[model samples]
Target: MTIRTTHVGSLPRTQDVVDFIFARERGEAYDPDAFDAAMTGATAETVRRQVEAGIDIVSDGETSKISYATYVKDRYTGFAGDSPRNSPADLKMFPSFLERLKNDGGTPTYARPMCVGEVRSKGQGELEKDIANLKAGMEAQGVERGFMNAASPGVISLFLQNDFYPNREAYLAALADAMRDEYRTIVAAGLELQLDCPDLALSRHMLFTDLSDEEFVKVAGMHIEALNHALEGIDPARVRVHICWGNYEGPHVCDIDMDKVFSTLMGAHCRYVLFETSNPRHAHEWTVFRDRKAEIPDDKVLVPGVVDTTTNFVEHPELVAERIARFAGIVGAERVVAGSDCGFGTFAGFGAVDPEIAYAKLGALAEGARIASGRV
Candidate 1:
């Protein structure tokens, strides 16, 4: 069987698109028409490049988005004001690293929109535009299979603090209800829907660090419940859930262990599970399948990441093939889809990886998938 390959979501945005997004974010005057044109060109170009690199499933590269989850602040209503500095618990452990980063040109503080009122769909036009661009890009590249990534309710709540909601459950439910439009739109347009639920893993430290391990799982489980509610009518086969322990070049000592949340992740309603496996901190976790092989349902597809996104070092095709082969050996080849540990350009211009190197890695990933298909 052919081993399908895909990435977590965001790809490197063209310099033009990058500049436009940054300019707008900085409140600088930029031509809206030019930005729109650049987004269209970048989407088409990224899609074509993915096909050229031998990727089976492509994305719009998220060229129009500023960041993965924070972009929702622009599309939805009720997200007003900002909350406290909710820093990641892992980062707090490395005070020296934080100082070094601060000394070396600080990171951009992306908007953290709080839930000040009721959530509603004000960004449907933007989403429709994204859909149009994806369809156009697919036609231009002559590639049919594609997917669009949307933020999960849990993630939105994690990034965008909620001072308005009475409690966590109420906030998450509202976010799920608001994001349903985007999810349904992508699937209805005949593309797979990739729900980015970093909260399931990352939040264990980032936002829910105060809770015990068991308590955090229960909290994360609620997020999955809200996600299922959002995905009520969509076919699970057409949906993929991507969970990560925060996508960054951090110590990651605080990341929730994969086994700790394995059951919670599988409990997600999506049929396809996309997770990180290439990062050094979590690379060995792929063996979990061998240990808990029986728990994986027959209908589920394991899309383990074979490419690392947090570094510039390009991985060899053989290494990627070996990674995929390992998973295939435990499960079956037909049930695996090669993926990236996380997004290459998760937050628009804030990618840790170099843009050109990111594409090279994709090429390596595709080539690696081809190699594994033969061996598996």
Candidate 2:
């Protein structure tokens, strides 16, 4: 039984790609043709790199996106105004550490656009370009198994505050309808659609800070409901959902426990769930899967992260094998896939891990999956 390897969407972007993305964010004029050519070259390089690193399942690396959630502002209507940035509660508690993080140039300046009008597809042509770039890259690499990421409705709602909708449900409904276009577009492109739904776990410490874990589950259920609506008619097997409690180097003391939201997350229409499993705070939570084994549908698969992305230290191949074996012990080796805790380069200019080091870590993931193939 061989363990398959994939990463959460997003690998490091080249300086030229980063410059073009930031230029669009700044509303500055640029040659659209030149940007497209640069992005295509960059994407092909990333795809070829992933294949060389021994990845089985691959992504476009989200080369065209500014950030996972905020990129929607460009494709959809209603996200035009500013939204105040709120630091995670745990981070705010340690003011000195927060200061140090900022001083270290950890914060990449980007806009958090708010929903001031109705949410609808604006016909921006970004999704189409994204699909073409990814397909071209995969074609060049002779890679057939691939996926592209789209922000889930819940996650979009979390970052882009809704000022137009009368209530949270209303806002979510609008987002679901609007984002449905992107969802279907990706699936229609003959590639798996990965829905980035960090709102499920990350919001507990960031967006819904006032609510207790129990209460937060109720709200996240609403988020999943909206996502399900957006996923209508799409095959569950063609989709994967990524959940994490914020992808940053910090004291994540207040992240909601997986036990509290595991059931709510399984309620999604997606068949595969990719989650953080090897982080310092969450490594012990593998027992959460063992404890709730009955709840996982047979058709569903688990992609547990065997590599931690925030730190620079590359995991030894043996340790990665041991971690994968732990999950296989609970759910069978056939049901598990190797993954990373989160995307190394989440935002265009904001990757904490060095680009070369990130690739080296992924290289370790491939080697480790090989090590776990039989022993599990």
TM-score versus the correct structure, for each prediction: 0.97, 0.98
Q: Rate the local accuracy (lDDT) of all candidates.
A: 0.88, 0.90
lDDT of 1 by residue, 1-376 (tens): 7999999889988778889998987789999898888888888888988888888889998889998888988888888777566667878899888677667643546677677888888967888888889889999878879999899998888888888879999998898889988999899999999999999998888777889999999998999999999999989999999999878787898988899899988888888999999999999999887799888888889999999998999999999999999889888999999999999888777778888899899999999999999988
Task: Write model 2 residue lDDT over 169-202, tens digit each, in one string.
Answer: 9999989998888888899889999999999999
Candidate 2 minimal-lDDT segment of 10 residues: 75-84
Most accurate candidate by lDDT = 2
Clash tally, candidates in order: 0, 0
TM-score of 2: 0.98
Off by over 4 Å in 1: none
In model 2, which regions exceed 4 Å deviation?
Answer: none
Query: What's the lDDT of the predicted structure labeled candidate 1?
Result: 0.88
Cα error, residue 7 of model 1, in Å, equals: 0.3
Quote the lDDT for 282 in model 1.
94
Number of backbone clashes in candidate 2: 0
